[model samples]
Target chain A: MPIPSEHQRPTRVTAKESAFTQLQQWIIDGTLQPGEKLNDIELAEALGVSRTPIRESLQLLEVQGFVKMYPGKATQVTEVDKESINDLLPPLAAMQALSTELAAPNLDENVIIELEETNNRFAKAVQKEDYFTALKIDEDFHQIIVDQAANKYIHSIVASLQTHVRRLFFHNSIILTEKSIDEHKDIIRLLTEGNGEKAASIMRENWLRAIDEFHSKKTD
Target chain B: MPIPSEHQRPTRVTAKESAFTQLQQWIIDGTLQPGEKLNDIELAEALGVSRTPIRESLQLLEVQGFVKMYPGKATQVTEVDKESINDLLPPLAAMQALSTELAAPNLDENVIIELEETNNRFAKAVQKEDYFTALKIDEDFHQIIVDQAANKYIHSIVASLQTHVRRLFFHNSIILTEKSIDEHKDIIRLLTEGNGEKAASIMRENWLRAIDEFHSKKTD
Candidate 1:
């Protein structure tokens, strides 16, 4: 059999992937509020795409626990419950720690410099109280490490769980910002020193700190 | 506005859910081998269902990383890659550890006795070289704690990851079974003594051991 040409291979982003990304953003940013009905027709019109892609996106979101789709009923954004945050944290922390461990052995000086630059940007964003910007920069910093790790499963799980974490950070940004900057510095220092185990442990502790901060806020 | 009646709530298991479960079992058990094409018409006929549910089931399985569907082409079972296992183990172990930690405070004498009984059955299954039975019992042993923890997010993640882990165990049964039984006994003893931290730590080590065993086998 002849090898399939490059164009014959499936493209990474289709109409459905685009739709999923846009809708996921809306959900994460609270533009699509929790408990609000997702009207496929209206969404398709708004997004300038067909309803099929919108419907497919909704299905994907449902699987990610971002939406609730009732058969023969409307789909709605799922509430960001404290219980969900609690449940998501441990796995998220574990994967982050694993990613660090895997990435450490492969970290080049260039990558470490890139991470430091990203951390600088993240610190600036946090200083400016730009929680959203800080969140994205923070993700970029971690994404580089996870990508270096070359573990697709951990990458995917972390990507999904980060949406919920982003929402939590939006509220607790002020309190988490300074500490988070320090934590990132600590992690970068450990990575620079080639201390993978200590870096992984610190990464886990960083996530646990977020969880603790969330609980304190919730109780308040 | 009037509230929807009890009958209006969507039932948990629709035809799609049923098809997903059955097809998943076939995939997990190796009856439907990796790279095998999933013909919707044939599967629908075999399962005594229609093509629509089969198609939907395939989609769900694709999302869960069990199968890969190409548009206007064949849907094939996904091969369980070592990288995938490596990515999945840390998160699975973390959630299992967290489950044990959460359930420790709630473990009654009756629950401890049930766990002991399950461990006994698990040991017997291993001794008899019944890996499938041992797998199921091992799942049951950990599941009780996860259920008791009442964290739906962890529960769902664990349940999905377990499908992949189950497949791995099926191949490495003899090697894993003996070590797994001892680990379960260790976990049970810790739980009996209400040493949640130690139990969680050991649980994490138990999973890491499996990953190590998988790697050693792969290298050989």
Candidate 2:
């Protein structure tokens, strides 16, 4: 029963929401490791909420694939399925590619600047070999495009799949290389030139590359 | 508080799952109309379950965007946003296109026959002006491709989006015409030829045509 250190409850959201968000983050960040049993009573104490919200939060988490609940038994975080990357990345790649295609023709100069800034940070982190920061910044780079695409359904689906991808990366060694930095630049240039088809193809391959990297890592 | 008459307690599932599935169907089919208030106790009695499962079902439905819950007030079915069709269809179109591309190269003879047979039924339904059966058969047609693609994440996201599309169609005048029948035939023909690129393009356009049809309905 590991409790988050920054356990102060946020204001405005219902107790259940606060609990659910914190619990999900902890699970994703590996603060609450895989197969770790959760006790609603203990978590209720840790989060400064009553047991009701804790119970409610578990129900939500279970539905979202973050946790598994057994009847009259323990609730545990789901283990990272490394193999899921194979099944996961293609559809995510498809959606990200579509997002790039949509955003290409519509990117405002300011958003393009933001993407440039995020990529700069990503390159710097990768240069320093801080893969954690680089991965987060990589998400920041993609988030800019997904936000620009402005389709709620695509936005939500990307967010969920990205979380699963992040969880897997957190549990294993991420193999992002200098090659990705160049692809980001190409994606930006294509968007600037409004060459959506090429940009989208590049973006889809950019994500599918992860499956390849994971396979290489497993073989290593 | 519509207690679905068909709600004889189902066997095998956890009560919460049974409640969630039935409630979601009721909402989608308009049995539980938009903005209608839900009372958990009443739902429990109707579904022959306890209030806990009914409450759990509401939480899940709210997360899935079928309902909105207000603190200390009411949990009501979310109203259909007619404008959402504009935002919703494009990503769904993208995913379906990708599914078609993936399923194309690998579709065996028997699978091709199943697709052709499904298209024949779709055409016959249209000839009889049976829009209901036609729409359902239309789902069966696309679903085969999605299943054949064999991506779990894509499969789940497509299922969720298709439900929303179906809900919107259920409430509005679905003007699916003979043009879609021909498109389905072309899709089958192209897929049989293993021309994935052309087949995917046609599949994308086939779904996007709904947005155009929806727009025409609005102006009419």
Give the Cα lDDT of each candidate: 0.81, 0.88
User: Candidate 1 has what TM-score?
Assistant: 0.86
Q: What is the lDDT of residue B39 in candidate 1?
A: 94
Model 1 regions more than 4 Å off: A1-13, A39-52, A170-175, A215-220, B1-12, B41-51, B71-74, B82-84, B170-175, B215-220
Chain B TM-score against the true chain B, each candidate: 0.86, 0.91
The sequence of per-residue lDDT tens digits that candidate 1 reaches over residues B5-38 is: 7666555667777888899989887789888998
* Candidate 1 lDDT over residue span A117-165, tens digit each: 9999998988998777887898898889889888766777788788878
For lDDT, the strongest prediction is 2
Scanning candidate 2 chain A in windows of ten residues, the lowest lDDT window is: A4-13
Tell me, by DockQ, which candidate is best.
2
